[model samples]
Target: MKRIVFFGDSLTAGYGLHKPEEQSFPALIQRELDAAGLDYRAVNAGVSGDTSASGLSRLSYWLSGPVDVFVLALGANDLIRGLAPSGTQRNLQAIIDQVKARFPLVKFLLLGMQLPLWVPGQRAAEFRQLYRDLAAENEMPLLPFLLDGVAGIKHLNMHDGVHPLAEGYQIIARRVWPVLQPLL
Candidate 1:
């Protein structure tokens, strides 16, 4: 089966307390692919609290062989922790390069995140721009604001207000399915 790797942090990992299949976006995407009769698999390579740096470290292990698609959804914790944006960009670029090198025909879909626009600096803009830059450079599919209508909404997020609830996952599935369909 063709494999689709969803590589990222807590949201992708479904960290907000629930069944893996129901909460994780990858599982939802899997169900969608199944219903649509797409011969593909969604592998959740998400590790809660992981940064783009951590994603880089595990790249070789998870990408040891040919992969049909890679959904890069990392860098959130790095942003929350106030890490340098340049480092995040470099790590992601490296991972994309490595994946393309090993699996030349592998398709990529870059998932971007957002932060409070009033966070008191240029951080949100810089972080958001990273996806645009990488997508342009690598010619990959780009999904702006992965959380979209779900983030910060009381009912959709967990008590911590960072992760998504089950309903939020549904919203995410609805949003991502169209973009993911063509890549599969």
Candidate 2:
């Protein structure tokens, strides 16, 4: 089967989920693919607390295998650590570049994150715009906010309020499915 690599941080990793192997977004998508009889596999390449730079550092491992689709969901950790948006953008672009070079036919989907408006700062605005810029420049699909319905929703998230619970992931899966289905 073809591969769809979901690369990102804890959100993509399904952090705090008791059964991440079966509850992560990637795993949920896998179930969808199977139910639809789609000839593809979902590969969850998410790592907890990974910044864009860190994710780039380990890109090769994921690229070692055949990749048909690449879903990027990084940058949250970078924002949390107050890293520069430019640096995060550069690292994310590098990841995209390397993946494209490795698999010319690989489709891409960029998952974006946005800080709440109450979190005041120009940096916050820049962080949100980076995804749009990257998506436009790369001519790829972009999910404006990965945690759209789940973010700030106490019940949908774990105590940490960052990672989503299984139910939250289900909503995420729903949001991503329409965008991802066309690519598949």
TM-score of each: 0.95, 0.98
| lDDT tens readout by residue for model 2, 29-57 | 99999999999989999999999999999
Superposing all C-alpha atoms, what RMSD in Å does each candidate have to the true structure?
A: 1.2, 0.7
Model 2 misplaced stretches (Cα beyond 4 Å): none
Report the Cα lDDT for residue 174, model 1. 90
lDDT of every model, 2 decimals: 0.87, 0.95
lDDT of candidate 1 over 58-172, digit per residue (tens): 8888887558999999988988898888888999999999898889899899998767677666776788788789889899888888999998899998889888888898999
Best by lDDT: 2
Clashes of each: 0, 0
- lDDT of residue 56 for candidate 1: 92
* Candidate 2 Cα lDDT to native: 0.95
